[model samples]
Target: MRRRRFVAAVLAGAGGTAALPNTAGSAAARPDSPARHATGHWQPRAPLPVGRGEVGTAALAGRLFVVGGTVQEGEASPLWASTAVHSYDPRRDRWSVHAPLPKPLTHVGVAASGGRLYAFGGFTDAVHLNPQPDAYAYDPRQDHWHRLPDMPTALGSIAVAAVHGRLHLIGGRDSHRIVTPHGSPVSLGFGTVSAHHVYEPGTDTYRQAPPLPGEARDHAGTAVLASRIHVVGGRVEDVGDNLTRHDVFDTRTQRWLRAAPLPAARSAGAAVVMNGCVIYAGGECRPGSSTDTFDDVTLYDPHLDRWKNLTALPGSRHGFGAAHLNGQAYFAGGSPTCGGGTSTDTFTLSLHH
Candidate 1:
């Protein structure tokens, strides 16, 4: 099925919301602003063996890992969840396959801590349906994944980050349980959630944290710096209802603070902390006939509490993977346009310069 048709099918059951306009008062420098743009250059890297999108990406023990995601056979093909796991070695400039997820999934939340890779809730079916609460931890030494405790709430498109040796699972969306006329519990209806949970690997326990402030959302860009977790733009209730809200959580005081909003509203963008700044790249907006993907690369300076534009991505894309490894930021896979097309393209930008 085409991307538009698939989205329409899901929306018919999930319902829709009024699209929010991008904030004009964001602290981010405008496109034609006189502010100086950050200097950086993107270079091509080895491509993935298969094209995919909505991948969970993280850096572990000097290697970058791309986990479960949506894969397309062709432009006219229907999308499906993948269980494949691939890792890239910056030193070797090559990609290697590893033990796959126990079940196919997409839009998974992933993070690396304590020398191990952890994956959280994600969608088990296509078009963001059937959210799961399953969790797993990967041991790189043995190239194996061990099932962990399920999250308190089942969801997909969640933003996850590790802080002080614990995994913080933030905003996402979940299927709304509604019994059908046939007595089936499988409903495509869904809603965004502000649920937040902290998982402790040592005790294998989870504690409820403060819910995200403002509206519930999914596919928000996230980064951790100085014991604070920054949550950027995301979709409010539907993919097309994107937001420019930026919220920061200070772990020390256990409080939430507001930060500069993104210059443009985006969801499913790749975000990573590099060189003391939060770098967010490529996201999607306005699905369907006027579908659009963002190519703008922007950086947030925590010290200045402001954002500035960096060099734009080579092309528009979303649902890709990004991680900062050895002074360079690596991005891989994702749909080149809005909706379902996938790409094998991978690239890197050095932070040393």
Candidate 2:
């Protein structure tokens, strides 16, 4: 009966996870992730209270928080690992269940400077084996969540961004993941990292930068225009490979540049910017195929650096929880099909171009 209601909503810890699969080759120069049309005006809100994937998203003020992930998998998988915490309030199109997360994580590295909400390092259960350097700090006006200061090593699929006010933790997959052979789930190899850190929340500190260019990635997706910090599309060297390779980073010349790739080639999607362009919505375009996710949505015109394939994600899924607030571009929970399935389906994108 629907995987027994996804194992009773994953053993009643409720609030999800599951949708891991990537590894695809043969499409060469990108651009082939399912394709449809019209997502150009987007607007369909109020849905997430459940249905999750490698979730982790942030945005303060106008609300849009959703953390941890893994709703369920197979082979006696046991709901993977989820520690729910939801929020969404685009001017009353509500959804709430906040305060949760001091444990259970899944490829975590969320961000929301100044107004609090920061939880880094993840994977405390399988799916790449344990790797958690606990770091938390949420305080939506005293809804509470503390514990910061951990993360000098021990990471998980990171790629968080906040810039200027600190909080830039690029590249990911450290402390090991992806080791198959003999017990073979069939992933010949693993381990990826290029370590780049910069936390600094008024002194919880972390400082190390400049080291991701030769190759090393994990669910990559980042955004912050002009002032630099792009890093797009991920999964390179055996996860089934996926990288159109477009890196930027330039917090005043910490250096690293090259853009205009990705006509199709995505990984762990949802790198927002909204209104002014530069987006990469709904991930996992190809890479060892997770039974087929990637419902396309690519647009980037950072003044013509080009890339366009607007709309497609009313279906096809992956570990969802993209960000951008106030002006739109929110895409909560995830997994419509592919690797695993989960969804609370909340969508909103307002860019009338």
Candidate 3:
């Protein structure tokens, strides 16, 4: 995440994890190390062909797919929201530009299911004002992209998780509709919606489910651990008012439970779990903090209900996406600045522990 426009996420069913090649040091190799025991190190990988932020990335069929987002061609080129889909093959150390989306969509929620890639609601472009209702599916085996039925409500920047055989979409925002007496945008902000939607792949249709509790929130991190979906660290009503509130939704009981809060409250981060620890990394922090974008990483062991700060990112960024492969975590395509400019470079965190 480039700390660029913050967003939330969800992973359902058995999400795929990429296996990383051995590049980082092992504890046995560092016998005198106290630091290695504290947190792992970050490794670099081949860069994305195009630099983008606020994009969608998901792993399907053994490859990582980077979906729509805002792309910066350069200082001279105009910033544009993108439909470009790029994929990375860790085994080949190579990248390929895949079929672009049918439309340019930024701030999209993406996931993989039924051996295909699914993209949910998104902003029409990086302008971030117009929300889209389109839902689509990409079949790599056929090199094809097709439209699925639109969401019951058009919302963008939501968290999606695949549980069992269904996709769970939670907490996103529609374009702000209310204005004030002075014609100013409402101060409370038009940031989040407390809606929960479920997509059934078998039916190619969507159904309503339970909404998130309390005030609406966006830009949270979501993951399925021990069979429950955990939503954490998002803005309550606006981008700057980030939260550390953690909510866990039980897929079986169809209810939510309060869980351990994030050590740092942030928006626009990526959440990934490996080896029993759910890691929340990157995103925007304070409004004017010198390093507004976060590079620091935190790991939460659900079994223990504790959080530990790991190694900081090689650099801070937000609006990116994360995937795990070969016992390591990979973050790709985000802006270096908390506000703008995208990076084509890819960074990896080695989970040696």
Candidate 4:
């Protein structure tokens, strides 16, 4: 009896695999099959309250926190900048709403450091243009939000991560205007940016890092492992007005290195580190197609410097979010298609082999 209790406790703390109640409609992670690499199969988890895309998510104290997104369907494009923060307690198989964000913002990127949550660069007040550089920090312990110094450049659709006790902000979109040597009716073509920014929490200051090899915005995925940061798969440049390429940046050396291109060029995807592999999942491919989100999942081994096509995601979606917890990757919410709206599905992929 004692041994059984200990095992149950261990599983519960490790994401409550066995404690997951057997319910007809509930999603549960399935044991690995022989054909499928022992990476556990995706189990359905609690769905988000609403379908959304361009959302932000971070992990704190072993709990997953997701916030900010948009619901643009029909004539009403409800800007979802709600301060409503949701906390998922896998141990209890439940989600509880914490204090809302100080302000509602969407298309923002979120990261966690020093036991606090920080959000930066998102759209607010119906401005889909460029995101405001405004920043906010949330204290789960105090159930409150506090403002932080704004970013030097206003940006949205950026990738953020906490590395070496500092917050690293990678490539993002900013307003660009053409300045031709001589004005022409057609001016020059638009040029995207690959600006990389870094923030120091202790000093509350921001600085410019190395630039990305290519200009990319939206749909990019990032991963930090073994003290190195990997930025992969997003739009490359205007491939007829869209860019889908892959690039990597080494924080230790402060330099950017090109990696093998993604099997498919996509945007708005999510990435996480598992078993020494960086996994990039979901997002829209190409343009002019409404909601062209894919259910594809790809894994890159930094040691081998190679990529493998993993099992496809059960459901297709993009603009969703992903995080790694106890060897499993949780992909939740976002739009099912490109131009369409968002989704509320929460799927978990167990990676064993």
Candidate 5:
């Protein structure tokens, strides 16, 4: 199947399209306070050596790492899962290729903990038809990858966060099956899952955590704030079924609480904690006639329970990588448009601004 058709089939599912509201600039502001936006501009950085999308990203040892994802060689070329891994040193503003993944995969959840990078479950092929439970850890000092225990359930597009020295693998999609096996048809069977599992690296054990409340979704943005895990905006089953629900899990209380919803519904965005706030940037949705990528950057103030706008991306992108290192947030290697387009552009916004 063609790249566009494959993406359409994966995102549209059966045969229906759902329209999303345009809420990019509709964040609710306090009546007593003026509308607020973060002060800064996205500045260009070193581009990726190879363009890709749906990559897993995390910061480890003062450097940002971009892991496995889908790669498209050209406009007409077929998309395939990639094993390429690259690390960027913001201090030097340079990118260096590191040891690649053991296998090609996309939509893998990545997190940094214990001086190492961990990769969670993801799709093993070009199409989002195969979900795997495999897990691995990367050590930058050794430039190697070590296989870890598999997750309890197979998943892709999961939200991963490291809190209290444990890795939390949150809601994702599973139970994938090809509906049309012949003739370049676009059809697939899959559903969102609310399975939540926590992994302890020290003991190499897994424990079941509370499943995500309200909705079972995938491609949600996640960040750790004051030991609380915040999961925001994702699709229920397909990109058209975007959601604005925000759920927070407090490590101390071991309970889930509803937080302020995202101003705009999105999926496949990057989330990071910066300046004591959760910053979500660059997601994709099928809101109108075509697949639309986002450049709208929004910041959530957990203390105030409010959201405000932030500096927009240099270009719209989705299925990309975002990590915070030093005092800046870095975004890299995502589709500039939507579907299967690829880009090598990298941009950064300072948290100190």
Candidate 6:
């Protein structure tokens, strides 16, 4: 699949804060006060116990578990080499070490299903374009690990969401080797895939489903509502290009449909459904120099068929993870710089009109 590269730009103002001019148009309607947009600030909380980014996170048994990400930028040493797993207690803002993954891998796509967390495909080593098909399951109840059938294809930067008790695996890169971040000439192979599949937990089997309208990977996706999965901005090429298009799939119909585009084009961001709206935060964009990353925040409303700009991250971030804890969305552990740098910082996005 063609992956879109997130634009990276240097922050010209104080403390490397990138100032983005709001795109022209009628601003997204304020459905209610205190719903975010008016308040452009994120509340800082306890940071991730481990300092890593490009990690995968999911909610299982009411707790957030983050797994396998690199410790530095442009190098896959940390993940390609470690199998450590960490669990977070959002209620108390604390972290605890848990049973490690069977293998050390990073850039994984994670989803909660059948009372377990399913982690699939990601770049495991510092090697840029390398991909893997290894899959694993984390059972919070037992605090243990188990292996599962590998995905039909080797995929990385995949987006996984549980719809109607089934796990939907979306578009991702299919290369088995690493590539340069600058889209430089390298032997690392690249291919765009449009395959979409759904896994049935009851039978431990995956079946083909309608592919996305476009072959974009490393995009953000979430179950904004029951039985519906919404996928937003992703790269169509493996070189990390950017695309703002969004799509929603109805499991009942096994079909995909076009929806609103993100206010800002992005890829490799995190997303979640909170308080009835699909909220996505912190990913990278292009037009960036060697140093900066995108700090933009965008929200999508299926009811209004539009996107609204909200608060930006305090600093540059990409590969950050996001999930709804309580009524707000909590995002953590993303690369401050493009290729491999990671941040342990965690923040809560307070939504208000």
Tell me each candidate's RMSD, in Å, in order: 6.6, 20.6, 7.8, 14.1, 6.2, 8.2
TM-score of each: 0.85, 0.30, 0.84, 0.79, 0.87, 0.83
lDDT of 1 at 144: 94
The clash count of every prediction, one per candidate, is: 0, 14, 22, 18, 0, 44
Model 6, 1-353: lDDT tens digits are 12334332311111211112123323344444233344445888787766777788887776777887775433334444346677667788887889987877777888887789888887655533567888788888898889888889887778888876778888777764345545654344355466788778778788988776654455455555677778888766532466776777767766666777787667777887776677777666555453456787776655556667777887778877877777667787887866556777888787665
Best by lDDT: 1
Give the number of colliding residue pairs in candidate 4: 18
Per-residue lDDT of candidate 2, residues 59-140 (tens digit): 8867888888776433344465577788888889988887788788886988887888888888776454577777888999
**TM-score of decoy 3:** 0.84
Model 4 over residues 72-155: C-alpha lDDT tens digits? Answer: 444565555555577676666567777887767776888888999888887663324445788888898888888889998777
Per residue, candidate 1 scores C-alpha lDDT tens digits across 1-353 of 22221121122122232222223333453453222345668999898878878899999989989999976654546456888899999999999999999888999999999999999999987567889999999999999999998899999989999999999998888867422324533334357788788999999999988778777788999999878899999877555667888888878877677787899888888998887788889898644423678899888866556788888899889989899998889999988777556788889986433
Order candidates by TM-score, high to low: 5, 1, 3, 6, 4, 2
Which ten residues in a row are the worst by lDDT in model 5?
Answer: 12-21
Cα deviation at 244, candidate 5, in Å, is 0.5
Model 2 TM-score on a 0 to 1 scale: 0.30
Better of 1 and 3 by TM-score: 1
Candidate 4 weakest ten by summed lDDT: 1-10
Poorest stretch of ten by lDDT in candidate 6: 10-19
- Angstrom error of the Cα, residue 5, model 6: value is 8.3
Best by TM-score: 5
TM-score of 4: 0.79
